[model samples]
Target: MYNFIENKNTDGVVFFTIPSFEKTKLVKHGFSSKIGGVSKGSYESLNLGFKTNDLKENVENNYKKITKALDLSIQNLVFSDQVHKDHIKIVTKKDCGKGIIKESDIKEIDALITNEKNVALTTVFADCVPIFLLDPVKKVIALAHAGWRGTALKIAKKTVEKMIQVYQTNPKDCLAAIGPSIGRCCYEVDEGVIKEFNKEFTNVDEFVFSKGNGKYMLDLWKANQSTLKEIGLLERNITISNICSMCNSEIFFSYRKDEGITGRMAAIIELE
Candidate 1:
């Protein structure tokens, strides 16, 4: 089971933990909620998305706070530019602080994986699902952002595949943690997304349930879990935080619930 930790500054944002990960003590990983930081009004505090209307200075301050909270050096953080595509970038020592220092430095990618020590893999999310991967045997870590589009593109499975191909990791030895995001109870989709799911999954109906009328709810967490299972991870090795970003708006930042104008939480993992 994974333990949840709260940030005193950020009211409702939290991170999850895996006991197996603690055994190595070589990897540091946490999922950030919308708490902690110094953005104001709509962003309040802990707004990580630089592109948001939030002031750059405040976002930088927030980044500093996050690095301090995690006991990591802000200069060593590596982030994804998150294009909502399936591109998975393999990080080396040279890629440290690329995205954070300058947006142009970050290659267009949605997921980041690396075996390098002291380089934290960070991804930002508002309503999208954040998936953390760790190879206890190889000591490699990955952070992935999966929205409906990314899920259909198999981003979670791709991250696992990248870990295997790049670091020679064994899926069975990999531990995965799925973080909070929009849940089925509040994630309603249109026919287009439904059609995409149906094309990929034989039992798509099981993951998508009708609430009433023409509205339908999609379980993105379960969808990503299914992808992980298909990629060869043992069901027991995966820990899922079932919190819903939409329903629990008080705790998490939900783009849907907040109407596209909101701060983003971050999920970070590194090899210590």
Candidate 2:
């Protein structure tokens, strides 16, 4: 249902763009992949995260690689510090280049929504979900980072509500894409996490499955998708990559697959 087109630039970096949003002409968006980069060791290549031990120069180059591929400006990017919360920051021209070049971080923000042109909103991911929303009619877009905690807080739903409050966006006119993350097959959780999800979502049974070992596998992709649909995004307009990071570690970074020390991938959206 989602069109994630893979393109390899001359630098050999593999990045993905949404074909659905590509037609807008007003914005450009894409997700980074594991392929193509300058970092070494566990980072290998294409790690856009700077918080890690990966050389600052390598991470910067990785960002440059993607900007070159997507025809975006690395300097115009605004990043989410991603505390796994539902907090949303409204982006504007003043916030451009905050997390990339001008400043180091935008503290405590997990989602970024913007209507301003050339201000690319970015959020990192490993096993957690990345929700991308675009309201073409309103010329607004949001990038949400939904870890299990953020999912329980219903970050996806919060993003939609924020768009409504800020841009007066109608959810029906929005396009949502749940990007690659750990799938139900590998995201096993204990009772504590299960309790959290149950507390926030009444229809938890729809996405939570029993593993029969005092553990449950949570389908965050489905959880976030349900959040979008419940908020009025058409089922047809929402797409799931269904690509599990744990399973495709070669092509994508996976927190679980790499055991807590791995490179990072980013979901980036920019208004033209």
Candidate 3:
């Protein structure tokens, strides 16, 4: 199980700490909120995405604060230029600080995985689900960004598969933490998305329900959970944060809730 830790810094962000791996010096994982940065106006503070209209200096400063709070080195961080796809990149020590300084250095990736120690894998999001996977036994960690399209592609399960293939990790020994995102209460989907989800999910009714007015609400968090379980992870190994980015826009950024002009939060995982 994982325990949620609220950051003392006014950033309103909370990270989940897994008790089973706490004593091990293997991996560190955290999901960020929008409370602790130097940006102003639309971005406000703690925005991690550099492509946003926020000042580059503020984004850099915010990265410093986040690294300090997470007890990680900015030099070893590897970021993703997410295109909402299922492309998972296997990061190595040589790829450190790639996407942060040079946008061209960032590969078109949506998930990052690595077994190397001290190399952080990061993915940015506004309302998309940030799924963090850790194989404490294998000392492998992966971070996934799953929006509707990525979720339909089963990116979370693909990340687990990659870990197993690349690092010899077992899904049963892996623990997953599903982070804050747009909950079903606010994630209304149209008929096309709902139909596609039905095709992908076996028990589609459980995660997708009618919300009246010809709209349907989809529980992406649970969808990812089911995907993990289907990929051999035990149901008990998944820990989901019930926080909704859309509902709690004051604490976290939401692209749909904020009309796409918002900053992004980050979910990072690394082997220590």
Best by lDDT: 2
Tens-digit lDDT string for candidate 3 (1-272): 22445554444334444444454567766777788778898998889888899998999888888877778888888988799889998988988888775443666799988888888898888999988888888878889999998998899999999998888898999988788889998999988997777777788887988978778989998899989998999988887878888988988899998899989888877787
Cα-based lDDT at residue 46, candidate 2: 95
Candidate achieving the largest TM-score:
2
Q: Worst lDDT window (10 residues) for model 3?
A: 1-10
Give per-candidate clash totals.
3, 0, 2
Query: For candidate 2, what is the TM-score?
Result: 0.97
Each prediction's whole-model lDDT (CA) = 0.82, 0.88, 0.83
Q: Give me the runs in candidate 1 sitting further than 4 Å from their true place.
A: 1-3, 7-20
Can you tell me which runs of candidate 3 are displaced by over 4 Å? Answer: 1-3, 9-25, 102-104
Local error of candidate 3 at 80, Å?
A: 1.3
| Local accuracy of candidate 2 as per-residue lDDT tens digits, 198-222 | 8888899999998887789899999
lDDT score, candidate 2, position 2: 33
lDDT of 3: 0.83
